[model samples]
Target chain A: MTHIIFDLLHILDEAGIDQPVAGNVISERLGISRTAVWKYVNLLREVGYVIDASAKTGYTLRKRTWLLLPYEVKRYLKTKVIGQEMHHFEQVPSTNALARQMMHEVGDEVQPGTVLIAEQQTGGLGRMNRVWMSPEGGIWATIVVMPKLHVDQIFLITMAASISLARAIRHEFELSALIQWPNDVFIGDKKVAGTTLELAADEDIIKYCLVGIGVDVNVSVEKVMPNLSRLVTSLSDELGHDVDRAQLFSVFLKEFERRYQMMLKGESEPLFREWRSLSRTLHRRVRVRTIRESFEGEALDVDERGALIIHKDNGEIERVIAGDCYLI
Target chain B: MTHIIFDLLHILDEAGIDQPVAGNVISERLGISRTAVWKYVNLLREVGYVIDASAKTGYTLRKRTWLLLPYEVKRYLKTKVIGQEMHHFEQVPSTNALARQMMHEVGDEVQPGTVLIAEQQTGGLGRMNRVWMSPEGGIWATIVVMPKLHVDQIFLITMAASISLARAIRHEFELSALIQWPNDVFIGDKKVAGTTLELAADEDIIKYCLVGIGVDVNVSVEKVMPNLSRLVTSLSDELGHDVDRAQLFSVFLKEFERRYQMMLKGESEPLFREWRSLSRTLHRRVRVRTIRESFEGEALDVDERGALIIHKDNGEIERVIAGDCYLI
Candidate 1:
């Protein structure tokens, strides 16, 4: 059910686009009594929406705050599926964790492009159970998607997400952000944002992918975890002012869809080329630590299927599917 | 809480083992009243356990039918974690699907070696969401584990499972079972059993693994699906009588742990050599189909990581990680 308040608010937006809308006009359109319409106007006033009422003009929406309301996000999103169905929560343990649980509960009913956004994640996960400091100022959200890809092609989703985030950063602030291979995005050596892509598969077939994004938008540098502030960079700290998270998120969704369509069409060449240009780990001396083994090698190239090819000192080129690549 | 019925039953077995002990002795041993002891004995008799209860003889276990009860499995289980904590259901949709949900519910509280077993799986999953026909008289189970290995080393779990299953078959019935790479256990040209390994992981760490195994124990060929009957075999069909499922499961759990420990110790040679000996896929003309592409190649050898090394027509040696392999 659409909240009556949202329905009334939407009418106010449509009417106040140019001129004031009369009470009788809204009452007729909504099929409610004039007394009920006036009562709703009073409710809107109580909810903090600035409204002007007169005997001649029914109501006028003077100003609206940029909270991450569904209408506010929908007004900006142009994507087909990504972030199409948004579930906003005030607080969650982790968006990705909640996404996984929801997927299990609904099973196939959980549609792709469904998004779960939170203002804060108390137990937000980093890779390998590491603590992710998801304060209220950061954009802590997870986008659920079902990608038609094989096991080897799973990494392509992560690639698309990273490319989308990088493009969004460039589009929004003209910031030259670098994408660290596999997932994290950085501003120079300091980290501004990161992406974690998780999926459920049956052997080679992928069931769903949960792409989690943590972008430090309006976070204060001094408020970050001790000893990590120097390594972490927030948009507000870099821009010398607060950055609108909803605007950045909207831009990201649009960019994400563009690159996602490219991947669906199997046009990986352009995606790979752009990712290579924005990567800081590529063509660098790095230590790749995998679960089974660790080796130091010169990072050569990432293959079509997203396998990082590294030339070892032992005259062997290793194709690493999943591992930690640390620049030495 | 221990079921009062089971508690009373355990006391009867103990008292009957040495001699036809009196009712007062059983009641004393159990710390229950003589009336409660007799009440439990009658309940056990109703449940199909033959107990000779008299004023002189407290209880005597005459026949214990072969059922995969938790206590029976625990009594036979020698391994540490594989089947230590079992979740048994009379009927379920899929053991793996249930296991995944349980893991999500418990989160980090989920311990390794937890097993989910079902007497029947109505919607058991085969790779790629294919319908796994799990009828009565089949072993439908999933073992949960947290493997500390790289993504590429994932196949090692499947390998150990196959090798352990093959060893168990040979040990129990003295029959030969061949392991087809990636996962299926074959007898001659027909498949007798198969395994499905599913996991939740990022680019680096594995959160958990659910290894689903379906063994055709006492299932009649005619009772199986029409198209699959000809290509599938059963233990009863091969052995000329119904085999004990609890023993087979017990043996499989032990063997799986043995092979699992070997892999953890970095002993891949014994595993590889044994897997090669039992593999019908080695050095065979096969067709490999992956998500990205598919092609015909001669199966040359399997590497330490358990990836099938195929020699293509153009002399390209390709490593096949996950795909359906067909004999040409």
Candidate 2:
């Protein structure tokens, strides 16, 4: 029964949204009876798929919910490792928290490219334990990776994720997307997406890494982040249309996989150069606040370890490894 | 009753090992009666304290168990944060495992300098998930630190720990203890201790880090590590006398606290200089084996991020961040 339901969804998905696939055609292709196809199509509709059906024209997929359902994502995902196995939730405490629990429970047995996604999070956290707004209509995901990299090289994982989000948004919508220093993606002068990282490692090897990404896709920025509305925007608000989140996430996985493979091979010069080219913070006057102190400087360059080199006004050149950077 | 018991133990501990204090003396110091003092002394004896008692003289603490009991370690410990709150077990799966679990369960509620220790570990793990030999008479400990450092600077925690062990051993026994890159302590061509690190971090900041140190204190190398007898040694084996583990641990905590403070203040040049001076692997012909490949090189120096710089025989200089190095 499950297989038939999945098969029916696959057929309708291949037919494309708003395009009808005749009932007889789906039955013939899946080697199932027409009655079985009808039953499965009803099941799919019950699970939030909007399908327009008629006796003569068959079924047309009207909409797939914004949720990153595994079947919806895997159908378009092209990466070999990423998204091979996925877990989806309508609401969770946090994808990264659950991912960390899973990593601890099933150490060494967890698949590297497994993905965990949630439509909403009640206890989401940003850097320094700040509460992140994770309402519905946003892409909140954690990708588990077992990279053969040193612990110090872990910032590269965040770099790859941020770059992937930027590239995916740019390629899909032809929008001008830029990367901020460290790991935030911006559209124009406002933030659209951000990335976080968690790692499990010993002295010599990184056992696993969790790269968490939060993109404000179809979120109502004014309603969700009213205090920071001027500093944040959503994709739908920018483009005046809701995006297909599953497709955008699939593009991100592919982009991430390509760069991840390069990093594992010790070929990160190209990635660094790409990050610099797509960077919006470099050579800009920015205020960097670390745990100890805050200072403003011209963002000169990023070193190999992803540390931002800042030339302060006091004629001192400082390397800020981890901090919050704001455009002045 | 618990306070009196604690007071009785404190009196005996202050009187020095095997030095008897009069019953009246303990009773007066604790503001209790002699009968109450005798009862508390009996309670301490039941919990693994070997006490010698006489009606004429008083109670004498003959022995404190080899286990790193909280009272035993805290009595002599004088650190601002490190080991201020300790959890000790007679046997556990692994101190680092329990520490990680506690860190997860408590999150921000956990104290930064909490220490977890075990007399023996049933499933101890070494670097790269190797089986760590955790016999009964070894120092298996994990220190929880919430340093205000970037994720890239985490290796400094391991450096501080390894240096602490080397310094403690040298200061106590006058033996020439040296650190092998990246985090192993050796004495005269044999390994005596090693360190492992685990971290929880986001893209811009580290939430918490667990530094695990395993020292062969009183372990019988031939019995526990028969396959690695020539490569491993214990402190007692080197000193030809059973070392006082609680005293040694207190010294180590002091050593660690000092260096940790220095690292937090960004005064790591002194630490790097100290590590180089006490290093047994630098300036020697070594075999470097990374996950990708292996090659012969001369150990030149370590970079600020703790990466080993090697001059390969092919006239190529390679910076190895995480790998095994063998002196050839």
Candidate 3:
């Protein structure tokens, strides 16, 4: 029944938006009774799909839900492998945590490019296990991929994800989206999204990598996370209205899949160049705080491995592989 | 009751091996009745403690069991952190998997340096999820540690673990235990032990690292793994008898804790130097097979991050980060 309903939706989508098809036409096309067609359309309506129905015209699709349901996202998804398999949840402790549990339980059976998404994460995490405010109307997702990359090169996965997010946000909202050092995306000066990558490896070979991303699409950032309000902004806050999350998610997955495939083929130069071009931290004076020490330096460039190369005040060069960067 | 049994065993230990202690003496030390003392001693004997009892001369400690029970191992453990808390099981799927599960369940409550060990793993795994034949006599254990290091530098944890295993095997058996490329330990030409490090990182900072070390102590390698008979070995096969596994495990934890502490304090140079001296793969003609390509080169040296620097036949120096290395 669910398949029939999704198939009905697909047919409606192919008929083009707001185009009405007769009830007899849909029943004949689907090889089902007219009563079944009406029932499936009602089912879609219950899930927030707007279908105009009347005695004169059978049905016309008006709007689809922005709730990030698998069927809704799949309808607009344009990717080869990424997001092909998705587990959508109304709520989870953390999508990354759930993804890790799934990988551990299933081991090799968990396919690459499997996405675990939650409408709300009760305990969402940012870099270094920091608390991330994830409320309803935000995209909290983790993507599991067994990339054909070395352990040292796993940082490129985060870079690619950040680039994908920035590009998607720019494409969707027509806002100038930029990336901060490491893997945080920005709009002008306020943080909009963040990407984190977790890796499991055997020796130097990567067993699996989890790319976790959180984007405040429709969230009221200041109201949800008052402590971090000054530094963060949501898409809805910037645009003065909510955005279609399902569409943004589909675009991000397509961009991510394209860049990820390139990295797998050892063609990472173009992706790295893109990351550099969209980076807001490069060529800026920044304070790099690592676990060991903190220092201020000119952010020169990011190497191929994604390490930040900095020119220090004492005329010495420092390469920081992992740290927190703040624009000075 | 378990605590009473362990306490009684400790009292017998203090009386010295083969030195008999009167029943009244134990009851006085434990503030228990003579019947209670006898019951506790029986409990200890049931769990593999060797105790000699006589009506005339109370009880005497004969020998401690070589089983790696927490009580048995803790009696000799010298480290302050590593192995201070241990979970011992007769059989498990894999110690590493269990450690990961424990961490996921309890999060920060799962302390660093905690050890999970199993007598046998029904579904043991090696590098790249290869089948690891973990019989009753092997030491299959995983130590969970939250190290203060960058994700890229996590290879050093494996290096430290390899060095510790090699040192422990050398100290215990007087064998020429050397480490192969990455983290496999060898005695002569056959593999005697192996170490695998799995890291969970938030971006560049390591959240926790599971250092899984498997040592074939008293196992019969040929009988257990016929295909790998020529490539692997056990301590008993070389020494002509079974080794005290508790002693070996205690030594390894001590060595590991020392190196781990040094790493936490930003003192990895000495540890890296030690790894260099004990490496069997360095300065040898070897074949490095990565996911992308395979090439043969002279293994010149290892960098601070444990990447293999190879001098290729084409007069170019290539750095191999993660791969399967075979000596030519």
Candidate 4:
């Protein structure tokens, strides 16, 4: 139902861009009454969307603001499952948290490709409960997927997400963004975006995977934590202009689905190749700290199942399943 | 509050074992009023507990039915977390399903060591959504735990559960139960019990793990699926008497936590050694089928991370992470 109005709004937008378009023409083409057209305009206005509706002229979109609204996302959303049914929240504690809650409520009824988007998260969560500064302009979203894979291959979901995020940044802004070992996305030594892949599964079956991604889009360094300012960078700060978050988000879902599908189809060479090519942590002196132990080593490569293979200084090769990776 | 009433019920039980005990005598010892004791007795009767009250003899517990009530579990529960908060459902779709739902609702506030038990689950689940035959006398329960471990070490949780279950069966019935690789508990090659470990976690953190265990206690083979009659065994059928469900459950939790704490403290060698010794899959020709592929190999020892090390016929060592092992 929202998608129908979203499509009508786009038609009005195209007509508005040229000149004032007639009400009857839109009504005739859309096969809806003129009163129906006026109803939608009022609905848009109530949601803070400005629609220029005159007696002679049909409804014209005066502006399409950068809101992570469902209608706005549906305009750019082009995927079978990922974001096919989008739930947009203006302000949430964390999109990842909400997605997990929704998954529980709906149970198996929840679709695989559903995406949850939030404009700002008061308590946005990064990996290991780290506070992600999700201000008004940041892209805080979580995409849910049900991958058919073994438990060992679950890490590949994170790997695929990392590759997709890096690719999305490169495609949208033409920036040379690289992946920093497990999940952080960076551009030329400064971090731009990061992803946290959360999964729920039985021993032999994966229930669902929530790919929570937070990208610093239009926020400044000062808007984030003071200490993080030295290490973090946003798309707007690097690009010199506020980027379209809706476009960036939609592009990311497409890239993620592509990589995710390949993984489900039992292809690792491409994902590994892409991840290895974009990863800066590989072949660098690194410190991997886990809950059990921490060690300093030179990261050789990520294995097929996404385990980071590292060669310790004293000559022991270690395979880290998951940990905090620091490039020293 | 429930625990206090549970304590009162135990007192009435002990006094009633020999003869009918007076309510005033019970109240004097417990330091509660006669009215307070009567209120507890009435509450117990409302839940289908039978208590015989004569004006001369006072209150006597006539019968404690085979019900997995909150008070029944709380009476025996002792631990820091695992069974500290118990949710007893008479007929849930699945204990594991309810446990996961509770975890979602309470979020992280749902403490570790919380246990969910059901008298009968209409749709009791095994691993990979298999329908577990949870009859009236069977034990259908799920224990929620928040283990701090690497993703690779996640398998140890299942291993710990297997050992705990085997030990509990041995302690309760003096039966020789063995551990099946991945998760089935068997006695003399006939399966007596099984466990399904469901986990919701991020790459770096575990949200919660629901260890769903189903034990055929008082249930007979005829009550289970007819096809499984030849391969399944129960504690009662072997001992010729109904084993106490609450006793078996409480014992299992204590054993589980002891092994769980050992794993958390990085003492996994003992668990691995125990699992290897009891494993029926080890040193046997087994066909392990994972999501992507399947292979026939000699099942060697399970590695520290709980990967089944299989020596393939053609001379390659295959590590089966999460799979179905069929002895061939």
- How far in Å is the alpha carbon of A173 misplaced in model 4? 1.2
Scoring each candidate complex against the real one, what DockQ results?
0.01, 0.01, 0.01, 0.01
Model 3: lDDT of residue A276: 91
Candidate 2 docking DockQ: 0.01
| Cα RMSD for predicted model 3 | 33.4
True contacts kept of each: 0.00, 0.00, 0.00, 0.00
Interface quality of candidate 1 as DockQ: 0.01
Clashes of 1: 0
Q: What is the lDDT of candidate 3?
A: 0.85
Q: Report every candidate's CA lDDT.
A: 0.78, 0.85, 0.85, 0.79
- Show where candidate 3 strays beyond 4 Å: A1-328, B32-36
Lowest summed lDDT window (length 10), candidate 2 chain A: A101-110
Residue-by-residue lDDT tens digits, candidate 2, A1-328: 1346777887888889999998779879988656445545644654578887766677899988556788878778999998887777667789998778656534444667989888888899876677889989899999999987789888788888989999999999998999998988999999999999988887868988989999999988988789989988889989998899889999999999999998999878989989999999999999999999999989999998899999998989999998999889
lDDT of 4 by residue, A233-307 (tens): 888989889988888888888898888889999898888888988998988999899889999999999887678
Angstrom error at residue B250, model 3: 1.4
Candidate 4: segments with Cα more than 4 A from true spot: A1-4, A14-18, A23-39, A46-48, B1-328
Between candidates 2 and 4, which one is better according to lDDT?
2
